[model samples]
Structure formats: C-alpha cells, structure tokens
Target chain A: MDILLEMLEKDARLTPEQIAIMTQKDEGDIKAAIDSYESRGVILGYKALVNWDKTEREYISAIIELKVTPQRDRGFEKIAEKIYNYPEVKSLYLMSGAYDFQVILEGKTLREVAQFVASKLAPIDGVISTATHFVLKKYKDNGCVFKVPEKDERINSI
Target chain B: MTDYSKKLSKTAQSISPSGIRKFFDILDDMDDVTSLTVGQPDFATPWHIREAAIDALSAGKTYYTSNAGLTPLREEISKYVKRRFSLDYGKDEIITTVGGSEAIDLAMRALIDPGDEVIIPVPSFVCYGPIARLAGGVPVYVDLDEKDGFTLTPEKLERAITPKTKLLVLPFPNNPTGSVMRLPELEKIADIIEKKDIFVLSDEIYAELTYKGRHVSIASLDGMRERTIIASGFSKAYAMTGWRLGYTLAPREISVQMLKIHQYAIMCAPTASQYAGIEALCAGDEDIEYMKAEYDRRRLYIVNCLRSAGFECYEPLGAFYVFPNISKYGLDSESFCSRLLYENKVAIVPGTAFGSCGEGFARISYAYSVKHISSAVEKLADFANKIKNERKL
Candidate 1:
C-alpha cells in the first residue's frame, strides 16, 4: 500500500499496469487498492503543481497569519471553518507557533488578496488580527521552479 | 584553391562530425517542435550560486589568479568531492577547468601518447572517442549491452583491453541511457581495472542526479584512487551549464601533467564562475536534492509513458534520459526519430548518434516540464501507432 501511494505521489499518471510491474503485484489488485483508497478518502485527488508565473496569467498568493479569538464552546473549530469556507482560501491550518492559524489563500491581484483580508477576513466575528505576506517571487514551490532559465537546447553528449 | 586537408592535422581531418549536429540544424527551422533531443538540464542555476557570481563581478574580482584556477575554488571542489562522493583529493590534486568537457580533454592530452590505446564504453557520451583521438590514442570501443543496463561488465572490459591499453573511460550515470553502477558493480570494474594496470577517467557529471541510491565513484574503491581521475562539474548538478566550470580529481602525478596542459592550452577557468562554484560547493546540496527528486518524478513519468506507448524502456536509475528500444517498430533509430520530428512535430535524439550499438533505440530526455513531456509522449504514441499500422499493411 505504501509502495502504491509512493508511486502515485511520484507520478499520478502511472497506470495500474505500471504499478503492478513496479511492485510485482496483479494489475487488477492494484486497481482495486487504488479504488478503495479513493473511496476511503485516503487518496483525495490528483493535481499538477504548475509554475503559473511562467505564463501570462497573473496569480497572487499569500500566507495570512491569523490570531483568532476562539469561542469557549467550539474552541478554534467554528471560527476556522468560517475562514476556510471562503472561496479565496486555498488551505487552512491550525499552527502551533506564535500564530494560531495559517491561512494560505490566493487572488488575481495584490489588491484582491488585500481586500479578501480587510473586507472578508478582518470583519469576521472572533477575528483578532490578520498579517499578510504576499509571495513576491517563488524560487521553488511544491518541488517545481516557477521560471527556470532556459538552458542551451543543444545536445550535451561527450 | 589550396587543399586544406593537407594543411590540417591528420587527426582533425579524420574525426567525423557529431551525428547530432545534422538533426539540430533541421530542428532549428521547424516551428512548434517540442524537443527532448539535448542532454542538458532544464533547470536554471540555483539563484544563490548565480548571485555569488554576480556579486563577484560587482566586487571586480575579474583578474585571473592562477593557472590551476582560484585556490579557494579548488579547495571547495576537494571538500565537495569528499563530502558528497566520499573521495578525498588534496587542493593541489584538483584542477578546475572550463566544464567537464575541457577536463576530459586535459586528462586525455596529459595521459595519451601516439599509439596508446584508450578503451571507451558506448553507447555513451560522444566526446570520449573524439577527445581520445585528438590526444593521439586509439579509441577502442566496447559496446555496452542493453541487457546489462549499459554498465560495463568485467568481461567486456577484459575483452577491450590490450597490452598497450593506457586508459579506460568509465562513463556511468551515462548520457543516452541513465544507467548507474552501484558500489558492488564499481568494485567489480575496479578489480578488473586494477589487474589490467590501466588508468580510469570516471566521468561522473551526473553523479548528483542518481535516483535509487547514492552515487559511488570508482575511485572510492581501495587501490583504485591512485589510478582514477574523476571529472565532474557544476553544469549538470547545479544546473550551471553556461557557467563553464568543471574540475578533475587525480593523483599528483596525473594532476601535475594535466595541470601543465591546462596551464598551456587554457590559463584558467572564468573567475566569476569559480566564485559561483565555491558557493555551489558550500551550499548546493539542497538544490541538488530538490532537482534530483523532480528529475526522479519525471523519470518515472517518461519511462511509464514510453512503455505504455509500446516501447521497451529500461527503468533508468540515474540521469534524466530514457533510452527506449524502438526496434519493435521495424525502423532504424534515425528514421524513427526523423519521422517523429517531421510527421509528429516531436524531436528526440537518435541513439545511433551516441554509438553504432544504439541503432534500434532512441534517447528521450525528461528535462522539460511535465506538460511538455506529456504532449510529446502523446505525439510519440501517435507516431508509433502510425508506424505499426503501416508495418501491418
């Protein structure tokens, strides 16, 4: 099972036959395991980690550090749910550091990202304060470089 | 008109042009051609390394320091080789050259005399044979078997050796095929080399790019260190191809001779690049790991795609290229590649460009983005189907 998950993690495009060959398991069994994993939510979904900065499309992402006032009954859960339910929120995490919550969100522009924080986020009940760190440049994200310089396309043999 | 053939050196006139250059000229004119032709890393030089070069230039550290390259750079290289590959050479034993290409040339020039035989395993890099010829040595070919993952076996080495055999070029983590020799494999080769009393030029430029386990240099084998000259560089690992910085680690006897050639033919490697190399050696381990993981991911993707498309791809353990056996399609490597280029708008290098043994195979590099590789593979599948259907008819 670990082997199947690892192979998929390395390359989601790997067919069950390829996995079977790699793990020396039956292709049908591999497929069944993958199906089970998906149904059980162990395998959520597959997505590409694209370097959008290479394209003409402008994408602005930010990691907003949030200090929230938790309700006595629900603790951080109720407020966290409200913040995460917003369309702009990409990922929400309960952090153990100085910040209580780390909310990773994205927008089309810097102003849009700022507006989401000021209008939607800051105005939420139990929201103590919000600090935003806009991604200026990404050297590497999710194990991919955004804009690697073009190397000489000539053959390097010899 | 003067017969320039008579004026030029015999060796220069005798050398054949690289087979790859022709396809490159054709590829240059074609539009929307997605290429997996070149054996270059698509990643840029990590920013910190590049920044160090920029900083050096800004500081006006432009003058050539010494013939053997800047001392600090040599020291860094010595430290790096020891740290990463577990091989030690004193600072003076290391000579930084203008890419691994120049280091190979320097070693060849230093070691080979007229009529000395140099054994080179193929289908490997193209340069080894030519460089061996340029040094007035006979380039003895030991064709690598696809069954053995293109690693040189003791039997092959023994067969290729002769009374006059002076050097054996060990090109593991190879170019066209991403074959890597593990420690046990290296030890076997080392034992044969030791018995034969020949020197080794281990080209480990792709050392940091190995996927399965860590790369083990043949020089690390006991008694082989004195007989091996390691040629590796920042180009492949740190993605600093344009920087033109590489180093050679050898015993003092060989280093002194190589240094003499380096001093005469090339005074020094570029100063700015030397500074960048220092930074790379000091803090480029993480970058190598990051890039290797990405390459490993892409390696699996490309190999799986090729296999699914009805090509037999030996799962490469290192390097970024996948040599898929295209023999099943009933076309030669060149014809298959050319047709793929012209008909399918995809460009891949013919395996014959590397050696005669590579006739029925093609080398596809996974250095491009996953999107690019996926599109190219689809086109390749289409090309394979067309050819197979045509064969059936």
Candidate 2:
C-alpha cells in the first residue's frame, strides 16, 4: 500500500502538507495522490471512528448470520446485492462457512434491528433462515481501541 | 545531627542527580500536562513476544539459566544480529545482562582500570559519564558539533584521546540528540580508534530506530571488530523496557571478564525475558518495522512542527527524540524547559539533562501519539509567541 494512504487510514485529519513532510514527499504530489486515490475509488470515504456507545445517542447493532439459496443464474452475488440495498444493513459479506451471508445491521434499538431481520430480511424469496446476534459492547472498532486512553504510567527519566 | 553526605562513597556523592529531576518534581504537582519526556517506546510489547513469555511462565521455566544466559537465546541473538544488522557473533561471545545498563556497567567494570581515561562524546546518553566515574575511569568528553549531526568526527575524537585513553564510548543512535552515525562517518572515527588502539564500547541501544541509510556499527568496520563491544537490548526495538533484558557482544577475552561480572552481579538475564527475547529475535522483525515507521512519521512531524514554531530543530534520523536548539530565547536549556513545563503545562527535558554541551538545547521525545505531541507542540508554539511578544515590548 502507498505510505500516504496508510497514513490517512490511521488519521484522516492529517493535511497533505503534514503528510508530505512526514513521508518526505512533495506536498503537491501528496495532494495529487490523494485526489487520484479518491477518484479511483481506492478511498471509499473519510469517516471518523467515533465511540457512539459513550455518547448520548441511542444506537444498537447486530450481526445477522443468514442462510439463503442462490438464484439460478447468479450465485450469492444477487442475494448480497438485494440485502445490501436495505438502509439498516451497514455491512454485508458473503461467508464461506455454515452461513451464506453475514449481514451487519444497525438501528436505534434492539427491536428495530430484529424487525429488519424478520420483516425486511426473512421475507425475501431467496432467504432461507436468519439468526440474529445483537452486539452487546464493542472493545474495538475498525483499528481504534474503544476505551479511554490509558495514562502513561511510566515515570520520566533521563 | 549526622552529616550523611560524608558517609556515602565520594565517587557516588560527587555525581549530580539528573538535571531533569526538577522537571519530574514540577510535573508531579501539575495536571493535564502534555509531556514529551519519555525515553522509551510508547508502544506496548508485541503480543506474540508477550505470549511467548506467558508460555514460558506457564511451562514453569522459572529457574535461573546460566550466567551467559539460555544457549538457545544466545544462538538466536547471534542469528538476529547477523540477519538484521550484518553483525557476526559466536554464541560464547554474547552474555545476557539485566538490561543494557548492566551491559554498559559490565563493560566499564571489566575494562576500566583506576586511572584509565574513557573518551565519551557529549550531548549523548546520560549514563556513560557517571558509570565511567563509578568504575574509577576518567571521563573525557568531546562535544559533538550540531553541524555534524551531533556525531563525533575523527578530528574531535583524536583531540580528546590521551595516551592513557583505554576506551572510546561510541553511542550512535544517541539518546537526547537522536544522532545516527552512518557508515562513512563511523568509518572515519573507526580509523582513529584503530590507530589509537583503544577498546570501543559501542552502545547501540537505539540501533533499530535509525531512519537514515542504516546504522553502521564500528565493529563492522575494517579492524575495529576486536575492539568494539556492542551493548544493546530489546527495550527500544521491541518495546520491552520493563522486561530488563539486554546483552553485550564482545571478543572472547572481554566476554570472559563480562561473564565474570554477570556471574557475580546479575547471575543471568530474567528467564522469561530471555524466552521473550528469543521470540523477539525470531519473529519480531515485522514488529520492529511497524514501530519504527510510526516513530519515523512522528520524528518528521515533531521536527517540522518545532521548526515552524520558531525554533531551530535538526531533522533527527534516529531514535525517538528531537533535540531542538532552544538557545534563541536568551534562556538556557533548563530555564527554557522549566518555563515550558510550568507555564505551558508541557514537559520536555532540558538538553543539559544529557550533558553540559546540551545546555542550549531541549529534547522532546516523539515516543507518543501524534495527538499527544501535537497538543504539547501547540502549547509550546503559543509559549514561544508569547515570549516573542514580551521581548518586543
């Protein structure tokens, strides 16, 4: 991977100028590279990894292990496309194990997610069975550790 | 009342406490101080290495190993230096000590006679002088030129060495200064040492942190192998400072003496840490690269930030600290750093903490998160602006 992309992946707040100095590249080149990455769809979007659990916002997320039959002309791609189009389906992946599709859904409450899985998801023609496991807490998200930063316990010495 | 000062060893008594001790006290009383004063890696020990130690503990390898340390670990260290550093060492030539500090001390004790002079470059690590004095050796300090990237040039080294010079302490990837000695630079210095025929105690503790071409050990040079003793450990490389594991690589004669000191003083390095050291040598190359890249980014960031904030900072190519010149404020290093700590609520070490040659400088460690360093740099920039405004008034 490009060093600039790696830097931005870890921290999107960093400016092109700062990254130029860090990677010892021209600032103009960094800007151009970032532009190319964005236009080429290599960079999907810049989003903050917020710990919403700590905020006053009400949120619930669940991973629904799905078992489904593929359409005759298409494999799991058709079903995955159908399931990903739903607003609550935050993440969708075709699995290689006991389950066919692994759908991650997020909503305001536990019932909202279960309602999506039951009414919107299970009602699909190709959908065979659905097993929903609500996420209780997040210890990590993306690459960021979901916890208060640990105080540096080391005593300063020369 | 008793006069306790007179009862202590005069050698120990004469050595002053670290100049940064005042900052420690001041910082202790403060709150929300964004400090860049750490001298070790901020990263945790890699989980695989830690897991190896845990495995050893579970397997009940609690007993002490040999004075020279576990043979497998010693062999692993041999392979590690060979592949990572191109350093060749036989198994018997390495003796694991309790951290690099003890390796340094062992080298000092094993080699120094009462009146021998040990040449050390200044504005480097703080331990060499005191340890040399304790070993009854006279510390001959040669101030490194900032223009030379705080590296000891051949001329300066030649000028400092007397007929009584027994050892020249080469501390590349130096602490506080963050100076790295590249091969050409080291080769020049190595030429002088070979001619002068003095033993070299090369402290490459920050060897893995070199950001330039590569760290060149004087031992790797032409005829200096027999004279050079490298004292290093996993503390900086693997972020295993708490493990207290370090070793010394030297010739058989010196290793024999160092082993004697190890037997008498340390017995061996910690058993579990030795196990972890083996794992680090075997599988921690990726971990080193990962942490070193993070540090390289932080190094460039801190140097650029300090330069923009109206200070003269050399782009450090090694280690985790940036020794920015703070002499422009018409204040000494200690005074400048004290004001930063008290007023800005940011703690960085005065350069004099490392050596008197560091009197006009300050060391800000980049062994921290970018956010943490940015906040401190912001406060520092504000403080510098205020100082500028007041001077104008």
DockQ top scorer: 2
Q: How well docked is model 2, in DockQ terms?
A: 0.76
Clashing pairs in 1: A158-B127
lDDT of 2 by residue, A1-158 (tens): 38888889889999888899888889999899989999999998999888999999999999999899998988788888889999889999888989998999999998888888888999988999999999999998898889998889887876
Candidate 2, residue B44: lDDT: 89
lDDT of each: 0.89, 0.90
Q: What is the lDDT of candidate 1?
A: 0.89
Q: lDDT tens string, model 2, B97-129? A: 899999999999999999999999998888998
Residue-wise C-alpha lDDT for candidate 1, range B1-393, written one tens digit per residue:
999998998889899998788888898888888788767888878999999999999999999869888888888888888888889899889999999999999889988999999999999989999999989999999999889989999899998889999999999899988999999888898998899899999999999999878999999999999999999888999999889999899999999999999988889999999999999989999999888877876787788778788888899988889999999999999999999999999998999999999999999898887778888999999999999999993
**How much is B52 displaced in model 1, in angstroms?**
1.5
**Model 1 - which docking category?**
acceptable
Give me the candidate number with maximum TM-score: 2
Lowest summed lDDT window (length 10), candidate 2 chain B: B384-393
Compute the interface RMSD for each candidate structure.
4.7, 1.1
